[model samples]
Target chain A: MSDEIVELTASQAAAAVHAGELDPGELFETYRARAAADTLNAYLWVSDRTPAGPPAGEPAATSSPLGGVPLAVKDLFCTEGVPSQAGSRILEGYRPPYSATVVRRLAQAGAPLLGKTNQDEFAMGSSNENSGFGPVRNPWDETRVPGGSSGGSAAAVAAGLAPWAIGTDTGGSVRQPAALCGIVGLKPTYGACSRFGMIAFASSLDQAGPLTRDVTDAALLLRHMVGRDPRDSTSLEFPEPIELPTREDLRGIRLGVPDELVGEGGGVQDGVRRSFEQTLELARGLGATVEPCRLPHAPHALSAYYLIAPAEASANLARFDGVRYGLRVDSGADLVSMYSRTRAAGFGPEVKRRIMLGTYALSSGYYDAYYGTALRVRTKIAEDFRTAFQSFDFVVTPTSPWTAFELGAKLEDPLAMYLNDFCTVPMPLAGIPAISIPSGLSEGLPVGFQLAGPAFSENRLLAAAYALERAIGFDSSPARRRDPGGSTP
Target chain B: MLERAQVDHVARLARLELSDAEAERMAVELSKVLDHIEKIRELDLEGVPPTSHVVDVVNALRADEPTSSLPREVALRSAPEPVAGGFGVPSPGAGGE
Candidate 1:
């Protein structure tokens, strides 16, 4: 059963469970055994066991295609009565009384959650290295990191911890890690997925996406995840279960490859560049018109993202004062000291750094100077995409410049790590859909290529990504960390 | 150069107190970040509106409508030290008094 069911794709597992070929109880036990031996740091908090859903013995619901599949939810999602730490000491025992709308949707759809995966404190870092529980070791290699702040989710999917996990991408958090960990991840068009219970990092940039073993499963998970939730007023009113484009042909697809982004010099690694070139060759082979375009303001994306994200983070995180919720420390003789000490100890270094940077950006005298101008730059970047899409259906680039590096290599140097988002960050700022799928392996590490589509073009983006995933013919069949206890990070 | 005083002030505003080493290191790193972020000073946007959000959509929300209650005690279960009705907060000079 473990041989047949354990190796199945999320959709395949569901089919077996639904067909009475696999028992939901045994299936849950199989995943539970795997998670119980977790040393990958992929999980933040895991349940000892999950109840076999529906019929007491058989697969439960008819509403879900992924009804009984075990999956992990990033700790950033609000789960009812479950301790969602948000990878911080602040919310140590925070069990929100209510579940997020997405969680409700998943439960209603009958996808049984395995546990909460780790993330950067409040979804901040590119490398899960920023997590307070320590870095989630890349399932591929013990010394390397899983891309973060959704590192736990990425690593989980990469190592078969769960078939696929739900993740939140704010400023490339989901896709970047997805790229590094060698899995397919999608950040649907900004307002597509409801953000009712996901912790807000940058409200404008934060969108929920799924990480999966393949695009079809990703498409299925995404279908269930999107739609309007009255709880999240920011959610858009989309048709129920928004159908993604299942286009078999790219004969009319206008693929744009920005020469500036296709780094010629030594900026991009040779293997990654070659992999992207090979991917473009596949797209060209598919009869898609591929050409070079330019977005002049593209270079300043990182600078703008740092300012904008931190500014929003500063404001959004202000609600976590040493009051109401989160870890409260009683220091000195006053409310001010208590607040100060509590936060100082509660938040990790990265979260505090952004809070400080954001507090400064949003400060009175600097508002017009820092936060204000970065917005203009963000607008310029968005305009760059809007202009490029005028001649192109989708913009393509390498998901991240380099593969997963050693865990502690860039954590101390903030700028070097922030550059990981050099290419992917701009898309979220434009509120567009971007997907990261395995292009190929560079040396021994995985390389991911992304497709950026204009707002409401998820169907197009998914179709292109699906075509690439099939044509590229990439697969990491051998699970990297079969023995989780051996990993270091 | 940023002084310990300025660092202290920033920390106070941020509700953080950096250790001496962290403060000194932050002073240097933040100065560099500030140098780059200060480019905004040169963009002449006398009439251009400052955009705070990207979607250009207004939040459609309603005033608070209470429906369910947490039975008071269930909500207060996790508070470190709580007053009967609310969490206890220390007043300034309470220790001295």
Candidate 2:
């Protein structure tokens, strides 16, 4: 019975619960036990209590859209009374007084809290190694990283510790991890999801998304995760409700393969490139038109993103000055010394490096040369995408340059780590939506094929991805590949 | 390339106190990053305007009506050092270099 329960996808579990075939409490316990024993370090904190039914006057769990499926949340989303640390020592043990608007909405829709997952500190770094709590291991290969800063969330879903999880993407944090872990991850258009109560990383680029086993689940989870909130002025109403995609063939669809991202200069690995080409061929077979398109400025996206994101981060993180919350180091000196000491002690090395880089970029003399230029480059990148969309319905690329590398492979080289976002950064800069779907394995590890569209085009992207997914027939179960006995539970 | 002194100056501007070793390491790492970012200077951005925000939202103010706020005790729950009724901090004129 436990084995059968673990095999069900989130959509299946929700359906079973709604039809009175599965008890919501029983469903919660099964996942809770697995999360408590998680050896991947995927979860930072697991809830002990089974969620109560919706509050009085609300619909029962069986009638709700989510139907009581449990969710694993990345630690950045502030859950009232639950430790929401954003995987940094600076905010360790600090629980927000109120939950994020997204968390409250999911609860109202009948999804219960499964646990808080680990991540890279303040959602920085490509691999999970930057997490202050320690890195999460890839379930496929324990020696390899799951990719990050949403590594824990992706790992949780892939390892079946949780049916689905939420992660924030600021330069491919969500999609890259999901691609490495063999699952679906979506980054909605900018302003599609509210940013309130989500610990800010890069204000303009941060957007929360879902990591799940399939495209259908990703679409379902995102349906309830979007909307406008007065607290987040940047958030706007989604033009329409998301519907489950049923398209199984991509007839009349046009895909644009960005030359700058996929060409030889991008450092794409042999296996990943092969898989991407094969997926394009498969799309062509499914009646879609595949053509090469150019985003000329995309080659420089990584440099622009690094400058812009860190510049915003330097300003946003200034609030952690030991006066209001979290960790504090009293230097037994003046307020200035105290502030400096607290921050230096609290933030990890990567966070400190970014803060220094940002400060230098925004400094009096250097501002025009660095931050100002990066912003202008950003406009050109957006223009590139806008021009490409005029000729194609979706932009296609390999989600990552390669499959998951060993945990410590790139830690010594920050440049190498930043390169992991090379193919995934342009869409976010353009404020467009993109989704990463598992195309197939590259050397026995998953390689994701990414499809991105113009702003507010999630419905069409998901439909196209759904069609490609059925045609590819990629197997998503990690347990089957790891152990024949299926003894994880 | 960023010198150690420049790294220290930026650290001070950011209100972070780094040891000599971390500062030295940062100088090298930050220099490499800046070298890569310098590629943007080759582009002709004469007429390009800087994008501060991707979405065009003007004056996103909400209603002036009052709503219940976090209670004093709940708000202070995570403070490292809570004073009689607020957060505690070192005095402005206390000891320092």
Candidate 3:
């Protein structure tokens, strides 16, 4: 049981711990040692070691689901008393006085908080190359990127650093990296999870979800994570206790393949394309009908997303002025100089670039031309998805353009980096639920299949993903991002 | 296309400084990207209303109760250098030249 216990999903681990066959403390110690191993650079910081000796006794239901499973949160999510840097110098060593609602929920569910994983400063970049800490390499290839800003979380889970990690998607931050790292990631309907503790990037678009080894694991962690929080007003009121079933229940479902999406941008990698098509065939064999569909405005989605995200980021990130919390720099003896020095010295290159682009778009002269126009474009994209979903149960696309590229390959060019989220941004703009499941691999890297549904359709989406997950049987073995023993190349 | 001078002005508005070489490079890159985005202007939005949110709702809130503030020392501790009254900083509206 101990041997099987190490590889079990978070749900399985909790059940075993409840039955007394496994001790929570021992499990915590094992994961800590794995996180502590130092090869992955997965952790920005880990809390003081808590062994499997005795519970911290926080009084959470010990027999409840996800009890005692260890999980890592992306640095962007604030954890009380933990230095929440968002992988940027601007927030250097800054500790939030409160845990994000998501982080708080995990702790309440008895999943011991593992350390925070590295991320792009303010969750701005696709490659994690923009992070102040350093890029988190894919466990599969040291030279390649892990796909980002949730890159650290994906790499950690792929390398078996932990069974599950929480990541935010404001674009493809969660799913793209999960796809690249060969993991299961789900970004629920925009309001499905509360954002009270998440540091805002683009308030309207940002979402928090899980990255796990498999769909069952994703389901277990998400069941505990998604909820209404008094602190986050955007949180949705859904029926409580969302439960997912084993693979056998997914027959006769409907999946829409938008012809407009799949063939554009040259679609996915060939190997991934083969793998995804095979998975589609597998679904048909299992009784799900697959049909070509249309989403006309989706073609313009990437353009509008780039504009809208920056415009919102310009306003949302204005809180980091020298007057408030986080990094502060001194200079020039005047109030304006004070702001310039603090922001210039604190924010990373990518962060500043976005802020400037956003500021320009929202600025007086350009506001009506740029930001205002982008919002109109965003509306059409949303309406397109709404109309398409009426006829199709769900829409599917290859999660990203290709498998993970080499680290620093796309870093120098900002446009190339922004294009990484090209496929995943439309759903967020539409305020719907989306999930990425490991469909297959190209060469050695993994590819992801995306499925999106109407708002609050998470249960049905989860059902479809679960059925598809077992059918695909994607395997990403020995994905070690950092082997302190120097075993990986 | 945004001119080289426009890129410089935008950078200043955003409080960033770029070397001449970096600025020139950025001019080329930003122009190309924005040109790609020029496609948005082609949309016939005629009377469409702009969307400000996706998951729309009023602000989530707690009672307007006062919360504890970080003590003066711990809160100001990360200041790169501090002054008598507050954390130090550069002039406003732009990074100091």
Query: What DockQ values do the models have?
Result: 0.45, 0.75, 0.44
Residue B48 in candidate 1, Cα distance off native in Å: 4.8
Q: Model 3, stretches more than 4 Å misplaced?
A: A1-5, A51-57, A247-249, A480-484, B56-97
lDDT of 2 by residue, A207-271 (tens): 99999999999998999999999889999999999888899888989999988999987999999
Question: Mind giving the per-residue lDDT tens digits that candidate 3 earns over A1-489?
Answer: 333555776677778788887878777767777777747577798756863422364654357457778888999898877888889888878887778988877777777787899998899988889999888878887779988889999988888778789999998899999999999888888878899879899988899999998887887788878878767777876665667656564466778887766874535567767877988898898888898878888877888888888888878877777675776665444665556667777887788778877877777688888878889988888898888887888899889888989977887888888888878988998988899988887887888899999888877888888888887877666574345446575
The per-model lDDT (C-alpha) reads 0.80, 0.90, 0.80
- Kindly list the per-residue Cα lDDT of model 2 for residues B1-97, writing each as its tens digit: 9988888889889999999899989999989988988998899999999987887778778889999898999888888888998888888873544
Q: TM-score (0 to 1) for chain A, all models?
A: 0.95, 0.98, 0.95
Among all candidates shown, the one with the greatest lDDT: 2
Residue B83's lDDT in candidate 3: 74
Question: Taking the tens digit of each residue's C-alpha lDDT, what string does model 1 give over A1-489?
Answer: 665566787887888777877776677777777776778888978878766454234336443567578778999898888988888878887998777888767766767778899998899898888888888987777689888889999988888778789999988888988888889999988778899888788988899899988887788788888887767777876544555447666788888887666666216888899999998888888888888888766777777789999988988887776667877777554877777778878888888888888887777777867787888887778888999999999999998989989978998778777878888888888888999999998887899999999887777778888887888888766554366455532
True-vs-predicted CA distance for residue A204, candidate 2, Å = 0.6
Residue ranges of candidate 2 with Cα displaced over 4 Å = A480-489, B94-97
Q: What's the lDDT for residue A477 in model 3?
A: 60
